[model samples]
Target: MINNSSHVNWRPTADIQSLRQRAVIIANIRQFFALRNVLEVETPCLSNATVSDLHMRAFCTQFNDPMSPQQKTLYLQTSPEYAMKRLLCAGSGAIYQIAKAFRNEEAGKYHNPEFTMLEWYRPDFDHVQLMNELDELVQQIVGCEPSNRMTYQQSFKEHLSLDPLSASLEELQKRGCALGYEHICRDEQDKDTILQLLFSHEIEPNIAKQRPCFIYDFPASQAALARINLQDQRVAERFELYYKGIELANGFHELANVSEQRQRFDADNAQRRAFDLPPVVTDEFFLAALESGLPNCAGVAVGIDRLIMLALNKTKIAQVIAFNYQNA
Candidate 1:
């Protein structure tokens, strides 16, 4: 992790010309929202609750009072999701936030410990509408061509020739072994993990290297906070946008069912216990808002750093940032 005391010579992540070009993209994005009537909003950086996704780890900190030696637990929010949803419940119409978010132990060509996120929510819009908006926005910003939509199942079939949701553990293991995958975890791995392995190893790399692709309709177990399709209960209304093999954004058909949300949170906490990670407190305020009803909406979180990297044609995520991990 980068700190403020480093003496190493470091350079900005992107070249000045490229960075300036990306600034235009940022401006275009804001203008797109402004024209759509989506209110640009801001929320707290510190929150008492963290995301309940088992794979998402929050950075926890302690606050001590000068008068006493007691410390209070606080966490750097991974995203502005929960707070934004609460505002939606309070009748805050379509909203968007371009903010900096922090995550521990993530530093790579596509990831950073501290990075910018462009998150937005659309009230009364479902996953399909959200996908259209994403495509239009990307095209407007980068002058990229229109994007194509494919379900997760379709992507798997097109690349791996396997039906991810129906594939058995033995079948997955056989495919992995054929591909020379080591440390087979078929017995412990779920459908999502199995599909993810194949997707990363064989499928994703070959997709629209220069164009944007929208992959949607994930399996129910992998939905995270999204709602499952009532018509096809096996799949959830979730989508992820990929460009040049880099994930740019993730979106979901918002799940406002408080009971189901609670169930998912409990399951995540249980997994955290199994993994020996500290338990995260549930956000009762967010739950109250959920209970009050969240509009049938779709929301997305986009990685600003990766967007800049792609726009600048930079090879590393560190190039866009002022300081990198080794320098900081």
Candidate 2:
């Protein structure tokens, strides 16, 4: 981390020209949405409740009441998902937002504690239609062609000669060990985690290197907010976009079943307890909105900084952001 007193660290990581380019990109994004008649909206950055995803840790602060004696803890939103879904439930059709998001336990070449997120929702769109729209938006921003699409099973089969969906835990462990991950005790790890490890370390690097690629239909165990496929009950209607092995976006065909959504939230909290992490309070309001009937929709959150990094051919995420966590 750079010392706070350092003069050079006070300057923006990105050059002035790059900042200007970023502005142009943001303008283009607004234009793209405006042409499609998608209303741009804003939501709260801090909330009384936050995501219960086991993989994400939210930054929190105590909100001391000046007029009252009560103090409440508020969490910085990891994504604008829940609030946007609430809007969708209120009959806001096809909305988008560019907002600041925060996550704890993240800081590296490709990650920062705080970053910009471009999130949007389409009320009647399915995951495939959303994927096509995402492809168009990305291509417009980066001047790249439409991304190649593949299923998660196909990616694993083509890259590692393994079927991720059908592979047993023992098979996954054996393959992981053979691939130089002997340090991990396969027997103690879950199948989904093992699949993630292999996909990140081996298969991902071989995905479309010159253009973007969309990997869809993930295992049911890996689904966060995505609905499960009816034809194939073992997979979820989830997809992630990657460019040169770097994940840029994650989208889901929104799960509207209240009972299932609550169960997922409970499971996430249970996993958090197992991991020795503090359990986050479930967003009751968001669940209430879900109960009120959120329209069938698809939503996606894209890392704007990472997109800029790729567009400018920059190696580090800090090169695109005005100020990184260390300096901020």
Highest TM-score: give the candidate number: 2
Candidate 1 residue 297 Cα shift, in angstroms, is: 0.8
Task: Determine which window of 10 residues in candidate 2 has minimal summed lDDT.
Answer: 1-10
Residue pairs in candidate 2 whose N, alpha carbon or C atoms collide under 3 angstroms: none
TM-score result, candidate 2: 0.96
- Global lDDT of model 2: 0.92
Per-prediction TM-score, please?
A: 0.93, 0.96
lDDT of each: 0.85, 0.92
lDDT of 2 by residue, 1-328 (tens): 8666755557888898999999999999999999999999999999989988877888899999797698989999899999999999999999999999999976999999999999999989999999999999999888887899999999999999999999888899899989888788356468888898889989788886989999999999999999999999999999999998689999999999999999999999998899898888889999999999999999999999999888888999989988888877
Candidate 1, 1-328: lDDT as tens digits: 8777567456664567766776777887899899999999999988878887777777889878576688877889899999999999999999999988988866777788788899999988998899999888777665677887789899989988999888887788878777877475445456566667888879889886768999999989898889899999889999999888888899999999999999899998898898798778999989999999898899999998787777677888877766666667
